[model samples]
Target: MSIRKNVLFACLTIIGLLPLSFANAAPDDVFIFSGTRLPTALSEVGSSVSTITAEQIKQKGYRTALDVVEEFAGVTVNQNGGFGGVGSVRIRGALSEQTLVLIDGVPVNDPSSPGGGFDFARIDTSNIAKIEVLKGNQSTLWGSDAIGGVVSITTKIATSPKAIKAYVEAGSFSTYKGGSEISLSNDLGSFRGAFSGMTTNGISKAESGDGNAERDGFDSKTFSGNGLIYLPASAKITAAILYNDSMLEYDGWGAQTGVSDADVTSETEELSGHITLSLPLFKGRLENTFLTGYSETERNYFTSGSKTYDYFGDRLLFRYQGTLNANETNRIAFGAEHEKTTSGRDENSIDSLFILYEIKPMKNATISAAVRVDDHSVFGSETTSRFSAVYRPHNDWKIHGSWAEGFKAPTIFQLSYYFPYSSKVSGNQDLNPETSKSFDVGVERAFLKSRGIIGVTYFRQNTKNQIDYIDGWYENVNKVKSKGIEVAGEYRLSDALGFEVDYSYIDAKKGDGNRQLSVPKNSGSARLIFAPSKVLSAAITMRHNGLEKNTYGNVKSWNRLDINGSYKLSSKLELYGTIENIFDEEYQQVYGYGTPGTSANVGLRLSM
Candidate 1:
């Protein structure tokens, strides 16, 4: 039998056997705010979504957002080197740029970036409360650049009267990490802030197979702050900011035209902030929110300490939203948003209006419809819509389905390329915004008595006007198709012991029937956890990264195992440890970039 067919059969047989091997009840206490822009039960959302809570982050030793989302289905992460290296994420076969990333619901994608995508490498998790991931097209509610869905991060804002938390860690390659968080809450308002930094004498990015000796290193610092002032009549004012500065040394292509140097360096700074006012009126039936924010990103690349190139991107956002709780079962929401992207090249602005209605026809069913129209200064107009429904036959089984449209505007470089060299690529001024239509259906079963839960989802997305190089210039000539299946389950044998597994299979291709680059066809991840007592908790996680075609060659599948644990020694002190790549899996997520081997770290946290 062929390898692809064999792999498919093995995956099905394994997932098909999970329910019989273990038992558990609904693990749906997770509250999601991104799916509907309001706090809603996990089981009620019609999309395939995942959440990583603060507790889970600690238990799994998740140091970055990338670590937290690796286990999610239909997600693939690629790194250029070791810790703090450039990272890219592809969701459900969509292009990396298609995924919309938000910090506190504020878009952070760099407009100057090659394709205007968020760089996962720059994210820091100093005071994150949760990471919410939504799959499939979400352009209807979120507007453009959300075709692949959204990854929204919420930082910790709630505080005690007085609290301070600190942590430190040290390990291989002269690596060091530390962070501190402080919070104050009073009758009038609340304030919280966090600071973190990390530095490492890292590994070689370009491996010669004989063990390259050139070492690449990185240093970074991050800060987060949130403040709120409670006003009279159930109103509040809030301010928030996030910042990061980092420097990294990496290898550039060797002698090849597209390759970089061996000792290339990069320095970057990014800042995003927001101020908001919220009010509740009409006897708590009507609510309103107003927000404005700005984001700036700048990067400089150099060789031999001499700056070779630089780029800067900035964005501004203003939004107003209102919600009406019409009755016990009917809810309505509407919003208007304006966003502008500015690079040195051009300033483009877009105005968007959106509305969503949710209906609970009965106790066991919820139906929602959303529509959005975006008017761009350059591209004229585009409209998108979504319809979703969820039905619960009983407390244990939920069936859900959704149909949605997607849209993405052409990038600045793609539309304004004007290099003088004959060899330089040119752009098209008349390129249309890319668009897509997608649908998904899924079934989930939850058991009672805290036994366990299982879910399977099937999805398909067809995209048109996918920008590609045709006849030596960028054009919308590709029609791409992507389909996938996701199977996830969590089982608990006892109150203190449990296991989880998530699997994804994707068949993605471009118009000419070529496999998508950097997209894995089959991948799976599993985790086992034990919490024998209130003071002790640990988990072992295993992940499989499937095959893909890359510049380095047809990369093979690889697996890794990581173990993390925590022990509470006292009310004010705790110890934690993590061992990564336990079996020394020497594989690469991005070809040519060296992957880390087995490494261990120890840390301590003091909290009050």
Candidate 2:
């Protein structure tokens, strides 16, 4: 079938499945922090944001953060191969390096990489408490590298006085996975610890043709911990730490053989941690927080059991923020940050200041404005701003709009790397920062007596001075324009059934009006959930990706189906299972990379 027909069919199917009567409505009081750097009601934030909770992650049987993030609107993920491969995420056709990723509120992008982008393959879902994705330019609140958006990942914390949970699963490709978590709480504090590991004998990274039958293998382990302490006089302290180690076997490319399967492997290690202190004064009218964070990443590559290349990167950050409740109808937030990034012998620092103001101008409307200034060691200074508004005309209707500006500084590797063997290929020290401007407007309405909700948004962005390799030299000579529409809906058909669907249509072009490479114009996902009883639940999900152009050729469109279910054997024990690629579809995300076929896994969970 054609891409257009597939999209039409998916839309029609979703509409046909939705009934007049919907199920339970989402809570109105849910709060998110990434939207404003302060806790704000989801209904009052005038930005495009999506959230995934731990319950949803568990229910969907998502093994990695990438699996859950790819299901959201205006988001795309591409991996070179299966587990442990290099994974990249883009928002609204923006470059992967333009998006900022955070772990426990700390930036974790690799400074040694040419683009300083985060690898989604390194993040496991077992220790996550929640994930918040804010789409569009976010440089007004965050600093540079937020031109695309921001993704904040929060680790698990204690939710009760005492609890313990564990799970184990085994499946095809000689794969085994397991994780365990424990939590404790008291009057003075709470703490949580978690550990997870997985190993798989995977398929060949190169396409399964031309004598490429050698099997690749992958192994990974992660440990994370969080702690909180209550102090005197409305004061508190919080700390978090995470560690990860992984090894992956992959294929090597050769000029003569052209992506032939060869013996190659890589090992990676990462560590990140942070500590924060909070204080409240003036009878809780003013709040202050001080934080310090650090992160380090190291990678080694090998050929035929001999180490051939290595890289190391690290970052240190210090920040202070203050929030004041000026009046019943107004609030203000201001902060300063200092960050230092190091890659091998090259390093740079940035100092930033930002402020945000929010006003409830009327009973049914809210207005917000923010501005930020960043001083870079090498690139001098840059300024950005944002404005947003939210209006609720009726109890069940909402309208929101926002205008924002963003920027991204060149990475150390992009600015300092040199090629002595070739005069044409070298980093440009005089490159300028990339800049972007974006706008979005959206409307949402409740239906079936607030049991269901639907939302649609239109967005556009223009970027200039984009840095890219041209004529064997890095230069800021690229310009891009992107526009898109997003539609998302959720409904409850009955007490035992629920439905959710989202779709995105994007048109991205370069200065010459050529379509951006590897960006699909059409993509969407839909899921149907059934829970006939409190003890059992099941869900089926469908995802579609339209055709995309690559340097080699065009990648064909594809569709995939997945099903998962769980049965509570007792109050503290449950059984769960999942089947992926149910049709055994043969598809490829990248031109020469291989993807998994039909696979299934079963697991047992214990809680106390």
Candidate 3:
């Protein structure tokens, strides 16, 4: 017998020997075509996936991207200021720079930033249609920044012919926001354009009138647009552009012994375009996509500091899907990408190619393998590979496992920046990328009758030649390990009520025999939702973060509650309100920084 046939028989035999818990009634309906590609149900993916739909965002009453991440599962944001504060995302207890953020499938990691982390203050979640978070090491599917995971933000696709929507909200600290979106569609294609502006007089951080810091806040604005062209057959092309300009004033770093005044202003622009073509080839559906993008960042500091950086890149992808036989299926994808970053200090670039294959030898069984090779301008060439599997004896239960290898390239800021601090501080222009391997296992189940889902997953990651920043120095550390467990679930009590709970625990230490610092070891969220009527909806959520103790002898912890509600007056208009920090909690994710308290926001949304 052929190898394909042998594999199919073996997979079917294994599925037949599983427990009855694997048998379950399917969902009432499928929400997205992409969800089926994952190993878990839409709700049970909490261990590795956190999804928030556009409707959820509207009902939650959030403003910035930072707000969303703060409430997301397995996510923690260290806020440095109020709404405009610098923020970082940590997944599986990884560093901020290890995570990757994507807007419509384009990377947003700043090439010139001090940490290569995307500035969350520049993102307004109001315009996002859907957000899908793939946690764990996804480097097998995505490249580079996938060492920790990937967060993909998809914009709203226009289907209506013509519409105009706008919203305005105001709250504490003289905060206010206003924006409008217009969509137009016809026989040839569709177009969507939006402009939003926000400003805040900002409140002082000190309590009881000890406010010495002035202009130590954030103010910013953004404009974005997108266009889609549909062909007669099954082909489409899309383009997107966004620009953000802002000014920030903050207390200087304690590097100089006393608080110094700092005023920083900068501008950034990002542009992306892609074309997709689908057709039948080799008895299967073939899809090809070509993408190109560019980003430019300019910074000006009042303390005689100025920098300009730009990056240009392109990528090509080819994917094929088909059925191998009566009870077998397969998918194959391959791609290549290249990027060049230009700054006054140096010109750096990377070229990479990868291929992946997924096969279902039998019903409810899937196996995938992938490999990638990258050529870096400074680090020569390296290769990585991954293997994973999912076994489903029935529709409701799945067993998943994976082993993967990934690496991260050093950003321009990490290589060239120099500062005045300890004499041991230094930046290595010849620094090599950090490399690591990860293993993960999980089980997921969905109970359709109760509309409930649950999942448990454990992950371990080991790294060698890790890069880190300490006391103004960038150094290469060796042998770091991290292990964690996540348990999450959701239940639908009735047509009008729902409940969700998520928790994560992690343990990590550096090879130098010190604990990784500034990361919470335990975190959780509990949410309750109510829809008393078709036109009205309400929700309440509580967040808890366990104190994290660092080797430097520092500990931090926080808890907060939020409530939101919305009422629809008609088919085209709705009113919403939210109260954050209902008890006026005094807390900060980062030491010495205070968060906004007891703030309230109300707004009206109009569609069509």
Candidate 4:
């Protein structure tokens, strides 16, 4: 047998010999972080939220953060090639630039990108504690680029006095990966460190036909550090840093299509860091945090080992967040923020102020209202607002609804890139900010002794002054109307079996009479998991992406299946394997791209 096949066989053999357990249990309550800048209870959120816990990532053997987000409702992923390629995500039929991504309360969007979107393909899942996806128009808390929603990623921090963990894995296509983490905590302070890297000889960027045989490969490395110092009073100092460097190969850019055999490469690096002082006053009834952060992104394009293009973007942010618990049933949060952005010779900045108030009118009902006003260097001033409510008629049901206003400002690329590189399609400095108003309603219930949950949601939004390419010029000429429905269910059938399913339908259109590009109208996903033994568990996943139109033409719908398994050898060691594209599906999310075929990988984890 081949070396790869042998590794898979060995992992299965070890799991087959382990003893079985029949007892299973579920928690009475699952809480997500809450507060103004933090997380809150799931029951209190009025928007559509899809969360993937750390335990779920490990149990499913997911290697990348994008893998976990793709299974959620109202989400679709588009990739140019295999792993490490340019990957973009669309939420609720919203534009890629409308989605905001955050890491530990810091913005990671790149103004240097074509549309100011974060490429999900570069996010590693090694040390992530949880990923929270809040869907719908959410511009109340976060300012711009939240016309779609927010993706909040929180990394693990040092909680134990001292601990260390490491992992290594290898698989097909000459791929290898490794990572290590260390943590230390005490009454005085806490510290954490982590490092991870992955490389692979990936598949080609073009399709299989036309003698396209050359491969496009990728390499990525990341490092993070976190520290907290205890203070004399009821307060502490927190600081963190995240850095990444990635190099990948693709076919072409600008106007031409990708070539099969080429050395065109792009190297990207990102750095983000923040420091904050949190304090408590009035015996903990009032809380305050002062924070400042800096984020920068850079990219270099090369052809035949010679540099061709260089780009850099930087952002500086400052904020003071305060929250007051006026009483047991009322809460108030307010914050002030200032931000500055720089790209090339173009510089722009903004100042903002916002306030939020929450009240519990009834024992099982909560209502909130917030308003924000932003003063931009270019667009003057704009005001946005939000109102939401959540009600629990009984212990078995929760209902939520919200009406929100959102906005997306013009990025450097869209406003001024035309000045330096003037082509037929030049930038327009007279562009205005895009605006949106949306409404959503949903209900959820738990049954069968709280072992299962089912929910359905309906949402709609209307956006005005949207910037687009009209008649070969940048203009705010499109008014977009989008709406969707999401239905989901999760049931633990018994002690040894469990299953879940999610489906979404979207009908999006522009006032100018055209369907949104690449926006799929129907999609769904399902998963089945089995744990026949205490030491072993396995899961199978299936996804269906419906038909959509692309620049090349109309594309057909496609389905994919994947299988993953894990085995615990001891308290400190575990083995895992994955089979992606189990059915050998051949399809493309974008035109003229090569999709990943069936592949396998095996890995081990050790902790102490």
Candidate 5:
């Protein structure tokens, strides 16, 4: 079937189910931080946001952050090969480099990268408490690299007086994984720490069906810690740290042929941490926080057992934010930040100030406006702004809309890197920053005694001065436009059964009217969960992707099914297992890259 017909059918299907009686409403008290840089209720934010909590992560057995986000609408992920291979994510057809990734409120994009993009390959989900994805132009609050959206990951913290948890698993492809976590809390403070690791003799990076027989290998280790200290006089201190190390073997392109198996390996090490002090005054009517953060990444590449190239990137940040509650109807948030980034021997800095004003003019409405000004050491200054509103006419209905502007400065590598031996590619110092304007409007409704929720959103974005490799150098000579529709629904059929589904349709084009590459025009997922008792649970998920274009050719549409279940052996022990790609589907996300087939894993979990 054609793409248009498929989209029409999906839309009709959703419309057909509007009259059914179902219920699975989310809790009203749930709060998210990425929506406004404050703890805002999900219904109060106008921007498109998706959140995955710790319970959902555990129930789904997600091993990486990438695994969790791919299930959402309007998001796409591409991996070069099997486990530990390079991975990238795109939202609403934006480039991977345009998305800003954060770890505990700290930006973690690699400055040494050609486009300052973050690699999602090595980010495990061991210590994650929740993930919030804010879509559309978000530069008004996040600064650079927010042209696409923002992905904020928050690590776990102590919530109980004392707790300990551990898990171990082994699966196909000679894979093994394990993790342990401990937490302690008291009246004075709280602390939590976790460690996780994984190793696998993975499938060939090149297509194994194409006569490639060599097996690539991957290994990774991660450690995370968080602490909170209570101080006198309504003051507090918080600290967090994360460290990761990984090694991956990949394939190289042949001079005459395409992807070929080769002995190429890369090692990466990264460390990131932050400290914050919070103070409240005026009988808690005003609040302030000061923070300092640092991140460093090092990468080493080798071929034929000899080192070939290395890159280092680091960032330092200092920030202060204040919030004031003038009355029950008015509030203000203001902040200033200074960040310095270094790649190799070159460094640059940016200073920024931003403010947001929010007002509740009516009983069931909230409106907010924000603006930011940033001064870059190399490229002068840029300004961005956003406006948003949310209204609840009835107890079960919500209407929301947002308009925002964003900009991305040139990356250090894009502006200064030059290779004497490579004549085909080089950096252009005259490139300009890319700018974007975007808007989204959506409506959500609850029905069947508030046991079900359905929502539909329409979003559009236009970007100018897009930088890309043209002729022999990086240049700002392109423009792009993307528009999409997102539909999401959740239903509880009974006390023991539930269903969830999401679908997206995107139309993306370049200045020359060509469709964007590596973006699927249609995608969706559906899951059915069964929990007859508190001790036993199971779920089946089906995911589908439409046709996509790549440098080599068009990638055929594909579908995959996965099944997972868990059984509580006792009050302190549980057993779980999963079967992925149950039919052993043979498909590729990127042309010439290999994908896993019919993999299975089993594990035991202990809690105390």
Candidate 6:
């Protein structure tokens, strides 16, 4: 037998022998750090929430956060080519940019955009500790862009006194990556930091021999680092920086249809930092945090003039939580946020304040609400709100429901950018913020006495006054609606074998008859994992994207398979490998874009 096959069999044998021991272990405690009014237990969240842990990321061999998120129902990613292209993610048919992203309880979405949507592709998962996704409108607590849902990424915070880890790998497409991390922690103080870089030249296509747009390739580079410090009195501080440069030198749909281009480049630089403090208060806990950051993005389409913009923002929050007591459970938080943008012909700003409150009426029931108001440079003022409820009837089952609203202020470019698009156009300074209302209801069931979890959710959203460019002019569309059903589950088949599945069906429509670009009707993912021994693990994943019909009368669909494995050479050394698009599917989720094909990479990791 081949060495690889022999290893797989050996691991399976070990797992098969530990079934009883695996089931007899102590029950685990689940925590939900990004849902509800505060960092609460998973059982306390009043709405549907999902978590992807660091171990899961490694076990699944996911190269990007977007890839891992696919396993969750109602989630889909719009990716292009090998490097940087406009990439986004959608949840329940909602636009990609509409979902809010947070880092350590602070918003990271670029307020400079009309939708305040940030591209998910710009983030690397190397430094991420965990991700918590809260599906449904979160506008009440997070304000704008939370109309669709929320994705919160929390970086690693070291607890050990000292540690160091490093890895290097080479993969398909002539891609190479390497990184190192160091962390120091003690009773008096704690500090952690990480640095990573990656590069890629080109990719091998499934259908070769032609200069097809899909054959166009790319080159990419990225550097990122983050640091955290903690004080003795429960005070913490953090700083982080990220930089990415990508060049595309190929043709896709844009090339096939006469808009042929050979060079497209995207560059981005961002730096962010924050400080937080928590203290005991009058019969409750008082906490505060302040965050600030800056980011710049420039994209050159070869034909389109290079567009550049810079953004700056800050946020401050304060909260008070009373201890849990019979018939008395309450927690409240308030915060203020502001952002400013600067660029040629594009200058804008916003200021807002928001608050959230959670109350427990009974032992098994809880209610929560949030509200926010924002003043925009152009749109003037807007308000958002939400309310939710949670009920637990059995130790293994819970039900949650919520209703929320959100608003998005127009961007400087969306309002003013003008080109010789058959005519001269002017900015619409009177454009109003896009308004959205959404709701969700779901049930979470844990089987095998809590060894497995299954969840189903139904969600709907209606957005009005959507901004669009029409014949060199900007206009507001009347209405847009998105509704969907999602089913997801995670099961531990054995101590060393596990599986997760997610499926979603979305029905999205525009009141004006224009189709929403890059939104798919059906999407799903399945993952199977095997941990043969403490030192060896492997995963197989499958992804499905349903056919989408564009407004221009074009249809497309895609499916891809991936495999990942890792082995521990010793207590401080490890080896890992990932093979993406194992079947080499050739397809596009976007109308005119190149997608990565089959690729593979192997690397070694060391820790001390």
lDDT for 522 in candidate 1 is: 97
Model 4: how far residue 193 lies from native, Å = 0.6
> lDDT of candidate 2?
0.86
**Least lDDT summed over 10 consecutive residues: which range in candidate 6?**
19-28
Q: Which candidate would rank higher by TM-score, 3 or 4?
A: 4
Off by over 4 Å in 1: 1-32, 208-211, 255-261, 418-425, 469-473
lDDT (0 to 1) per candidate: 0.83, 0.86, 0.67, 0.81, 0.86, 0.67
Native-to-model Cα distance after best TM-score fit, residue 291 in candidate 1, in Å? 0.5
**Superposition TM-score, candidate 1 onto the true structure:** 0.93
Worst 10 residues of 4 by lDDT: 19-28
Q: Mind giving the per-residue lDDT tens digits that candidate 6 earns over 543-593? A: 888877654435377788988899999999999998888887877655544
lDDT of 3 by residue, 1-608 (tens): 13223333432333233222212222214243222223234432222567787888877766777777766656767766565666778777777778877776667676667556666766788678778777766665666777777777776655466778998877767777888988766555666678887778664432212344554555677766666555555565555655577766555454322233344433344333233333434443555555654445555554334543333222222222222222237666677778666554566777878777777677677777778887878877878888777887777887887788878888776787666675854466766788888888888888976499887888898877778876677877887888988888989999899998888887877897776766778888898999989899998989888787543334467789999999999998888888988998877566555567788888888887
Q: Which stretches of candidate 4 lie over 4 Å from their true place?
A: 1-39, 253-261, 419-425, 470-472
Candidate 3: misplaced stretches above 4 Å? 1-47, 205-217, 255-284, 303-328, 422-426, 448-450, 549-555
Each candidate's number of clashing pairs is: 10, 1, 0, 4, 4, 2
Model 3 scores a TM of: 0.85
Please, what are the lDDT tens digits per residue for candidate 2 over residues 1-608?
Answer: 13223433432342233223222322224354798887788888898888899998887778788898888899988887787888888899888898899999989888888889988897988899899988999999988899989989988877767789999999988989999998776666666778999999988887785567888899999988777766899797777888899999998884433466889999998877777888999988889999887777888999999999888888888999999988888999999999999998889999999999999999889899999999999888999999999999998999999999999999988888875655755678888899999999999999999879999999999999888766567788578999999889999999899999999998988898988777899999999989899999998999999898776667789999999999999999999999999998888787777888999999999999
Residue 113, candidate 6: Cα error in Å is 5.5
What is the C-alpha lDDT profile of model 4 across 498-545, one tens digit per residue? 999999998888886787877899999899998988889999999899
Top lDDT hit: 5
Residues 82-189 of candidate 1 have per-residue lDDT tens digits of 677888788899888999988887898988875788888867666788898888899987888998888888887745666799999998888899999877666666
As a whole number from 0 to 100, the lDDT of residue 370 in candidate 1 is 93
Question: Model 4 Cα RMSD, Å?
Answer: 8.7
lDDT, residue 492, model 1: 94
Identify the runs in model 5 with alpha carbons over 4 angstroms from their true place: 1-32, 255-258, 420-426
lDDT of 3: 0.67
